[model samples]
Target chain A: MDGTRDIEALIEMMARLPGLGPRSARRAVLQMIRKRGQLLAPLAEQMSKVAATARECLRCGNVCTSDLCEICLSDKRATGEICVVQDVGDLWAMERGGAFAGRYHVLGGTLSALDDIGPEDLRIPQLVTRVREEGVSEVILALNATVDGQTTAHYIADQLEGQVRLTSLAQGVPIGGELDYLDDGTISAALRARKSI
Target chain B: MDGTRDIEALIEMMARLPGLGPRSARRAVLQMIRKRGQLLAPLAEQMSKVAATARECLRCGNVCTSDLCEICLSDKRATGEICVVQDVGDLWAMERGGAFAGRYHVLGGTLSALDDIGPEDLRIPQLVTRVREEGVSEVILALNATVDGQTTAHYIADQLEGQVRLTSLAQGVPIGGELDYLDDGTISAALRARKSI
Candidate 1:
């Protein structure tokens, strides 16, 4: 209302973003307009490029500019071990750790009873096919520690029970966690997994 | 990144916005991608249009698509009283308040000695010309309550000492403010401006 119709429309659209409300969107739009050459022009160009080139990897569900993502194409990541995650974000997290030398399988989301999500809605069937066809020896479930994540993990494990070896990431306190701050569930899990040093 | 180069670039650009960080930018981009036709495509188009059309009013320093802003062109707002503000944002704030019937003159920014900003850097010269030409009887300095805002207001007041009636927004406790929570300056200002009941 304070600017041109086009500017107002842009602000309205920006306000629909996850983090920005109307007020923040207005501020952002104003800044962009003020610094058009420095920020707005490049951002608009990048967004257009992403809208045109970005696509999901056919094999693993990760986003890529081509048919297959970089990780899916890399021979180094073909360790006959597949790390199954709930989303591409989780797959990236695992990659950032620099420990896993295997490829990834993104489920898109976990099976949720309340949300009416099931195996068919996810990459469960594709995961099964990959395990059998790609000579996968291990299937690591690196899902979140939520209820739906656990249920999906169990479902996947049951499906691949005799077909392939299945495992999941452990649940415990974080690396920089304080003992006093640890929840009862974590404390119990830590105690149960305790080993003599 | 979890996504392609194009998508990563878009997210990086979004992260530079005022309210959004990298994490929130990722979320926003993901949502936009999911609703490409309904949201992302339209938003991109609108941004492009805004980038091309948005301009500042040469007379009042307000954002516009043409030579004059909406307020500057509207005959309904010519109340012979000019509400002076620090920026278009402050002008918008006044409009949202719905108390003023007069038109506005956006100053672009307050006079900042630290930034070496002076009256020439703002619309002070244009404001003087407008007052003389429009037969303006009153000039309201609806500037911010900050030190720079007050300093700018005093400077303007000195320039137009006898040209027109000068006033400012009252400094006092807000409508729903608690006395215990208010600072000493605000409390003192409120006490000094207390009305007879």
Candidate 2:
């Protein structure tokens, strides 16, 4: 118990992470101590490096080491299209899918009237400016299927209406998703948007 | 993506911790980055401190900053009774229970014939020396009920049979455990060890 105080403080800080709790944090700290040279030192070094350098992209709100993110700076990504997302996590998810070859505009959060968050609070204004200034011909709303996500998408659509071809991700039974497990709203939407083969 | 390489490395290291996977690690890293000043920086500082200070207590094999653990140095603990456990985690578990006021002897691990682990591989010789020199009256083998745990317990018992009183933990229905949910082995043990009201 001589050094438990410092270890306990480390556990407490680790417990504040998204997926870790007190018990897991304690185990993690113990393991880190056990592999101090291999894990703890390198992890601490990486965390410090990230804390010192990591910043949001000025253009698209993506996390980056510089003023602009890699995706925002890359000339290979299509300038004609801009995909709108709720946050950096969503942008990463889209990139992992590897379907889209365009630039992304991370809104940082949804429009929540209950929480008093407005369009201006998000990156909506920045998105509109990008659409106009960058000669974007299409704007894709790839926001989540939540109520707040839909509301935010609708607001962005209104902001950029007629200026570009506004589109949204199609809602239906996901590939490999079971019809029996599908929700009523999804079933209804899928039925209404049915296309003939 | 520019800063993601460092972030990904952090995630990989985090995923190596017990009870965490790659997805959870990614989520944790993102949350930490988002709260860099409040969480990431402090966590890094704590980790570095722990890494620099934490070491195994020479006397008890418990993690501590000094040469001996707090419990080993405490005069309040009953040196007459030695509770032998499998590892530091098991010692911590017993400490959490707060039932035994005696000091602990951590064996580190059980004797595994398949793994070529013997008495020399564990702290058995040190435990024997403590029992002889410390004037210990009782030696409690509070080891796990696994085959290897019982094997190690029996081995230790053989070494210290004539010198001190030897005992092991009772095996029966756990507190708040239901008979319907209990295993046959436990039910049989409980019946055999039944006491008179």
Candidate 3:
């Protein structure tokens, strides 16, 4: 325990991460110490580098090490369509899917009246400007299915009404999802939007 | 994802930790980026410090930032009872219980015939020298109940049989353990060592 204060502090910090607890943090720190050259030193350097450079993309609020994100900088992604999502995590998820070929607009968070979050708090004003100035034809609301997400989508749709086509991701049972395991809401949504083969 | 190469590498390194996977690592990195000033920078600094300073205690093999650990330096811990554990983690676990007032000897690992590990591979030679030179009266074999742990404990006992008193931790059903949920081996051990109420 003596002279282990720094290691203990490191464990405490690791425990504050999203999924780790005290036991796991202690294990991780011990392992890092064991693999100091291969893991601990490199990790510290990488973290410091990221901490110094990581910033939000000025155009879409996505995390990047520069003024603009890769998607926002790519001319190929300027396909007259802008996908609006609640957070940078959602943007990353959409990118992982690789179906969308257009640029994105990260709102940072949904408009929550209870939390006093409005369009101004998110990047809604920037998104509206992008849609108008960039000659966007379609504005897709890829926000979550939560109530606040829907409210934010409606607000965005109202802002761009008649000027551009407004749409949202289809609500349905996911691919390979068992009907028995799905909620009633998903089943109903899937049934209502059923298509003939 | 272009500017996220450093961040992605950080996540990959984090995923190598014992209890974390890629998804959890990604989530942790995102949170750290969000709380960059409060968590990321401080954690990086602490890890670098630990990496630069942490070393094995010369006396007991416990991790510390000095040649001797706190317990080795403390005169009060010279109680003539040395608790021999398989690893520093186990020693920390005993310290957490706050029952033991004596010193500790971390063996680093159990002797394994299959892995070709012998007394020399662990700190057995050092432990023997410590017992002979430190005027120790009692040595508690606090190794695990595994086959290799028992083998190592027996080997140490044979080495110090005539020199000092030898003992081991009691085996039984854990506190608050129910008979129905307990394993047969543990139940039998508890019954064999049953104490009168």
Estimate, for each residue in B1-197, the C-alpha lDDT of model 2 and write its tens digit: 64779887888998999889988887888888888889888888888888888888887788889998888888998559999999877888898899999888988899998999999889999999999999999999999999999999999999999999999999999999999999899999999999999
Per-residue lDDT tens digits for candidate 1, residues B1-197, read 34476787888888888788988888888878766777777777777777777778877888888898888888998899999999888888898899998888999898987999989989899999998899998999999998999999999999999999999999999999899999999999989999999
Clashing pairs in 1: none
Q: Judge candidate 3 against the unseen true structure and give its global Cα lDDT, from 0 to 1.
A: 0.91
Clashes of each: 0, 0, 0
Measured over all alpha carbons after superposition, the RMSD of each candidate to the real structure, in angstroms, is 2.4, 2.2, 2.3
Worst 10 residues of 2 chain B by lDDT: B1-10
Tell me the docking grade of candidate 2.
medium
Order by lDDT, highest first: 3, 2, 1
- Return the lDDT, model 3, position B85: 99
Q: What is the TM-score of each candidate's chain B when compared with the real chain B?
A: 0.93, 0.94, 0.94
